[model samples]
Target: MEKEHLIDKYVQGTISEDERLVLEKLKLEDPDIQKEIDLLSDLKIVTELEDKTDLKNLLKETEAKLKQGETKVIPLFKKAKFWIAAASIVIVVAIGITSLLNPFSPSLDELYAENFEPYKNVVNPSVRSDEDIDAEKQAFITYENGNYSEALTQFKALYEGTSKSYFLLYQANCFMALSNTKQAIPLLEKHSTEDTPLAIRSKWYLSLAYLKEGNKEKARELLTEVISEGGFKTTAATRLLQKLD
Candidate 1:
């Protein structure tokens, strides 16, 4: 089946179970298809809402004309239209109230700031003793104290010394804190598909890195993937995608 045919069936709510599954999979893999579906849905809602408003206005006009005896007989078509319009008024009013109550106004940067917080030092002890520790330990202290430049330097040293993936995640976050998303992107991208604890988190942060870099398209792509994969980040990713849309 063609995309157009599938989409038509989707809109009509007549798609087979297998076709629905296939369309949903396509939607996940293709952002353009998802966007088209969203647009179609929105258009249908607005058209229905507008039709309701128009019907109400038309009924008022018709009633006024009838009272004034403007015309002798109401045409069969007018009577049918009037009854149809009256039947839907309740439904329309309910929909109108719901739509007015929940409006969508998404701010991408605000959402990012609200959602992005540096991961706590769970890999290390939350509280440090008086021991003179190594560079990695010192780096955590700098990071906790909000000295990102020093933290980045220390984290780089830790990576050079050990080549650990955790260090890369930490260093990438430091760059992000400094608003250096360009530098953070590659590091996060490296771990996004890995099986490490930070893998899913890396995908989330990578999307944010793209967002901060003004790459909305790439950000949306990653966020969509995060939503599809389904995890702790799904809700946040879905919210971010709404704003991006």
Candidate 2:
């Protein structure tokens, strides 16, 4: 079977027993292939830290709006029913305007910016080491520092040597950070169905990548899949899908 097809079947848990045997044989003979499998399985621990700081700011803004509205008092001569109706209209209008002006709904770019944080580095030493290191280590250091160009170059070179899924995933993320969604898309899709650690999350990121590429149909399709799969990011996928609608 073709490598891509085999990978998808295996990841989706639909590979036949014979196909599983074939994949197992190939995995045994090729170190790089086995490394790819292992890395994908390992990357499953990835977690996103919500940016609550922004949420806090939003709450503060809402409070300020409410406080400002409270300052207005109707004169005793005003009709009570008219004042009540006017107050209700003002509240409804304020809410509608707030929703319309929400920074979160502005564009896919803003949504991507809100959600596409780099997966924290799990491969390299947390601190600089004293010993001589390989290209992967150097690549991660540059990546951790947000140097996408250098990190991409290094990751590309490392993948040529290791052919690991982690390298491919990180390389794709580098392309994403550099606004090269075309370059990132195929790489992320390659292992999008694999049962590896990053598999489900890869679909989520791939959906974002589709959004970045302005393919809302593709984005919605993948987001739906992510939501149906229902694991680490179903809530996030739901939120994104709602925005797309």
Candidate 3:
């Protein structure tokens, strides 16, 4: 196959494995082939972006105007100049959009950091009396004090002993605070399925857990649910969804 055709197929992501091997070999042999591939990849992005912007319509209008005077003799050189100028404009627009999309966009980790706070100790209000601080109160105190490891141990024991569903949520929050989304997600998922008052809040934290784990699709799914449920993190979920988009 011609190198040009291979490069085009590569940028379109329609190249077969054999063709990919050929292109890889060509890239190694001639660095200019890789540059051409990069340029074409950028053009493909620009083409898609044009659909969302007015650029596609502008180009079509220009073409229509150029084709209108079919009876009049138009110079080929003039048409070439017009197309060259249009191509330059398209390239410039592509670069601008790429820059805006790439550099300024917050990463998933950043979004997670910005959006996630361990669901506050609403389940267990802190007791100032210090006299009647039981295991449950102690667990919440540890969590509120940011001692996640001890809180996790306490919450796990409470959940195992009483099977109170809120303890599960607190345990998940502890895991999240410790940066252990792997452990947090399953607990949050299980808690979110219950009919308790904290179920919706569990979904919110689950979304954040997924976000922390770099699972945007699951995070988006939970965020959408939080928004549609119409309370408890709806506004925050909406804001997070906008950032993800």
TM-scores for the candidates: 0.57, 0.56, 0.62
lDDT of 3 at 176: 84
Alpha-carbon lDDT of model 1: 0.71
User: What is candidate 3's CA lDDT for residue 37?
Assistant: 59
What's the lDDT for all of these models? Answer: 0.71, 0.71, 0.78
Of 1 and 2, the candidate ranking higher by TM-score:
1
Those runs of model 3 whose alpha carbons end farther than 4 Å from true positions after fitting are 1-100
**Candidate 3 residue lDDT tens string, 76-118:** 2435443464466467766745654678688988888998888
Clashes of each: 0, 3, 0
Clashing residue pairs for model 1 = none
Tens-digit per-residue lDDT, 10-35, candidate 1: 76567899999989888787656755
Residues 1-245, model 2: lDDT tens digits: 65445544564467899998999888787545554443322222111213334434544554564476532232323455434534554565455545646766559888888888776687776465547766777789899999999999999888888778777788888998888888999989986856688777778889999998889999999999998988878998999887876
Could you say which candidate leads in TM-score?
3
* 1 or 3, greater by lDDT: 3
Name model 2 segments beyond 4 Å from true.
Answer: 1-104
Candidate 2 Cα deviation (angstroms), residue 135: 1.9
| Better candidate number, 2 or 3, judged by lDDT | 3
